[model samples]
Target: MKSQRHRITDLRTRRRELQRRAATYRASKGTPYPVEVHLLLGQTYLDPASWDALLHSRGPAVALRRARFAPRYDQLLRRLEEAITRYERP
Candidate 1:
């Protein structure tokens, strides 16, 4: 049986480890959006061009990935607009 102080110390250590994992993931992976999305965000309509074009230039796999990215990116932009509208009311 662990003492109360030891249990508390163990729990705190566990929490620190979990926080470190979370921080590392966010730093490395840039959560909520992929590197492809980030790269495209500044470009016209999030780059990618058209499905057929992408398939031709890049490949079927990249075309497929970018195809899914457009709508999700637009949805994220819409949500950002909504949040701005809701929060920035004068």
Candidate 2:
């Protein structure tokens, strides 16, 4: 039974961490794609679409079920991870 404020704070913290990682990656590789992808992911985590879906889900059981069926959630996360991995390669 986490409070909404805590959840929002967690999301913000995750976004900030992603941005920091993106900055580090950009500094190391001198590329914009990794930065762009990380920023996009951060934005996505804060977007209304995500909040609306989260709000609709409510309880833990329903939230898990909603996550399993959410159309773009997994795809977007996977794409972000793939982009980061590609950037990490020499």
Candidate 3:
């Protein structure tokens, strides 16, 4: 078992890694992903329902644009299929 101190250190390291990835992603010039996708990607029944509610309440979109986002849904579905295939019984 990892000591509490070790777990905290790991958490800090993971946080830094995520921050670095975010910075790199921001620097990239590819078609930008809406910050809202992370919100939309989140499922309401999950442990993070409070966060999902907050994100869903506020839109990165203007009043003219609805907060609907399905951009990553297909890709996520594909990945879900792949994962299910991996666990399928012979």
lDDT of each: 0.43, 0.60, 0.37
Judge candidate 3 at residue 1 and give its lDDT.
75
Q: Candidate 2, which segments miss by more than 4 Å at Cα?
A: 34-42, 45-82
Candidate 2 per-residue lDDT over residues 1-90, each given as its tens digit: 655535544554555665577668889879776565856666456566755656555778756655453435445555665666677677
Tens digit of lDDT per residue, candidate 3, span 14-71? 4344444434554663433344433322321123453244334443442112212222
| Pairs of residues clashing in candidate 3 | none
Root-mean-square deviation of every model: 20.3, 5.8, 14.9
The true-versus-predicted C-alpha distance at residue 89 of model 2, in Å, is 3.3
Which prediction has more favorable TM-score, 2 or 3?
A: 2
| TM-score against truth, every candidate | 0.37, 0.48, 0.35
Model 1, total clashes:
0
lDDT digits (tens) for residues 37-79 of candidate 1: 3333333232334534533445567656555654564465544
Once fitted onto the true fold, the runs of candidate 1 whose alpha carbons sit more than 4 angstroms away are 1-57
